[model samples]
Each structure stands twice: as C-alpha cells, then as structure tokens.
Target chain A: MSTLIVIDQAPYGFWTGREALDMAFSLAAFDQPAAMLFTGAGVNWLRKGQRPDGVGQKSAEKNLSAAPLFGIEALIADEHACQQYGLTESTMLPGVELVSNIRDVLGDHKHVVFAG
Target chain B: MSASNLPERNNEGFLEYATDWSSDVASVIAAEEDVSLSDNHWEIIEFLRKFYNKHEMSPPSNRLFVKAVKDALGEEKGNSIYLMQLFPGTPAKTACKIAGLPRPTNCL
Candidate 1:
C-alpha cells in the first residue's frame, strides 16, 4: 500500500510544514511507500534558494534536501498556486512535479495524511 | 517489541529527544533565537491537526499557513513575519518541530 502526504504550508516559516515533512520522511524511513502532494501555500516549500540563518535554527532546507535519500521522490507542487504566488518553474527546486491541483494526485493513493 | 513497545517517553527528556538545532549542546544555545511558543503556535498546531484530519497529508509550503492566519486573524495579522514573531526559534520549521510534527521537506 502507498501513503499520500499532503503539504499546504511553506517550509522554514511554520511548524505545520516541518512536521508534515518529518512524518513523510519518517514513514519513508520505516520502509513505507509514500508520495507527497503540494497544495495552497505548500508550494513555497518547493521554491529554491532558502536562507534561514537570519534566525538561529538549523536550516529546515536540509530536511527537504534529504527526501530522496529516504526514498521520497514523489514531491508534487501546485502550478496555478505557484503562478499566483509569483513562483515560476525555474525558481523551484529539482525533482518537483508541477501539477494543477493536489486532489488529482491524492486520488491515486490509498492512505493520505495532512501535515499542514 | 510489543504493539505498545513502551510509553512514548516520560516527558522528562522531551527537550533532549527533540532534534538539536546546533551541534554543540554543552552550553546554552542562546535564547536570542528562541521564541516563546504562544496561542498562535497552538493555532497553527491545531490547524495542522485539522488539515491532517481532512486530507490525511502534510502541509506543503507556506500557502495554507498564510491563508489560515489570514482567515483566523485578519490580513494584517497573517504574515510570515507574525509567525516568526510568535514562534521564537525559526518561524515555520522550528515551530513545527516544537509542535511535535515531522520535519518539513525541502528545508534543513
């Protein structure tokens, strides 16, 4: 069975995104099949070039970068929302699937969890 | 290990079990970056819970966050700046860790 994780929050800006990603990676680490769907504000996480040093916490970007290592390559993002947020395809990180709505991806998965 | 391997934790080592932001844990990690977890933090936490309940998924970027804040508190009050202000450490990622959720992808 496959697990679907949905993200609608931005990384490094809120706890929701962080927790959600952690859960996704943890699930993957535990040897579960999983895919993440990005919606709403979650698309910002895919945006490349994050510099959170202004504060003092470890860069949340590191977690995102480790997804593939844990076998979590199904990173999806919302294209329309990205356009609305002024984010273009060129600005997103590598391995992101620009989709119309996350629901389409959600439809294919058996188990889904929301972390935003 | 049984289904219930052990009590998750006694709460004594909650802080210790948390992911260390810095490598050196010998000394105080400077409160300058830490922010007090507040109602706003809870609000986001609850939002994450509901979000999970509805979609059974994790939050993506910051879209749901800004939207939720704007919806709950007015537009003026709903910004990444406010999230950062309320949650002392790092705005989104750190606060989420404190909230006991998983680490967000794409952030480190």
Candidate 2:
C-alpha cells in the first residue's frame, strides 16, 4: 500500500518536522511506496535558497532533493499554500509537483500520516 | 597531525565546520577509532564528504546510509557487512566521525 505523509509545520523551527522528513526517507529506504504532501506553512520547505547555515542547521532544500533518488514516488505541494508562502514555480526546488487538489491525493493513499 | 592542532570538534569528535577537514584530520580521527587509513576507507570517506556537500546532511540513520552507498557505489561496497568491516562499531557513526561530517541523527 502507498503511504502519504503530510507536513503542516514550518521548517527549522522544530525538530519534529525533521523527524517527519526522516520518517518519510525511512519509508522510501524500505521500498515501501510513499509520497509526501506539503501543506500550510510546510510548503515553505519547497522554496529554494534556504541557507540555514547561520542557524547551524543543514539546508532542508538539499535534504528534500535526496527523496527521489532514495525512491520516494513524489513530493507534492499544495498550490494555495505555496502561494501563501510566496513560492512560485521558479522559486520552488525542482522536481516537486504543485497540486491544486490535495484532497484527491489524500483520497488516493491507503495510509496517511501527519508528521510530528 | 596532533589532536591539539586539529580543528574544533563537538563532544563526539566530529568537525564543527566541514571546511576544517583535511586528510590529516581524517587520519587523526581514524587513529582514535583504531582504523588505519586504507584506500578503501578513504573511498567511503570521500563519498560521504561529497554526499554531505551535495545533500547538506548526513544520512539520518544506518539503513539510509547503506542505501545511499548502494545507490552511489553499487552492491559490492554498499552492503552492511562490507561497510561494517571498513568502519567498525556503528558504521554510520564511525565513518562520519572519520570523514569529518556530522553524526547521523538517528544512529543511536
């Protein structure tokens, strides 16, 4: 069965979001079919030019890019959320799918998770 | 190079700044881990450093670390036993330490 992970929190503010990212990577690592959905402030994760160096954190932009190579089926972002966060097609990290109807994505997955 | 002359490290001995790393620093760290710097060890270390440069993070856990190695280097060097031999203890932790990268977050 496919798993859909949801992230609603902003990046770098909390470790839980990273744990969620790690959870998503773990699922992909095991060959469990999985996809990630970005919503709310979580869409900020899809934006490019993140430099967390001053915060002493690794760039989430770079980490998310590895998802596909590790076998994640897709990284989908809510278009409304992206608009709210000021992310455009050119501003987002490449390879992410910007979707207008996230409910359809929710309906398609057997297992859904809200990452902590 | 003496440990005293080494770049700053965290409590666990990983370099505080990745730019502080060099082959000499890797050797000093490896010496503490009881691993001599063989070409095979250097290969994995270099791969990890490049991986960090590209991804800006260490593989979060041991399983992902092996998967990443398999993805990049193929099955021969990617399997756990082969990596375990080259880097004793938790291979992810040990190798990251010597490679001058951050600790794998979920390794413990």
Best by TM-score: 2
Stretches of candidate 1 exceeding 4 Å from the true structure: B1-108
| Per-residue lDDT of model 2, residues B1-108, tens digit only | 988999999998999888889999999999999999899998999999999999987887788889899999999999999999999999999999998888887778
Deviating ranges (above 4 Å) for candidate 2 = A13-16, A28-33
Per candidate, native contacts kept equal 0.00, 0.56
User: Model 2 chain B, poorest ten-residue lDDT window?
Assistant: B56-65
Backbone clashes under 3 angstroms, per model:
47, 0
The per-model lDDT (C-alpha) reads 0.59, 0.89
The alpha-carbon deviation from the true structure for residue B15 of candidate 1, after best TM-score superposition, in angstroms, is: 13
CAPRI-wise, candidate 2 is medium
Q: Each prediction's DockQ?
A: 0.03, 0.52
Q: What does each candidate score in C-alpha RMSD?
A: 17.3, 2.5
N/CA/C clash count, model 1: 47
What TM-score, to 2 decimals, does candidate 1 have? 0.51
For model 1 the local lDDT of residue B24 reads 24
- Residue B24, candidate 1: Cα error in Å is 13
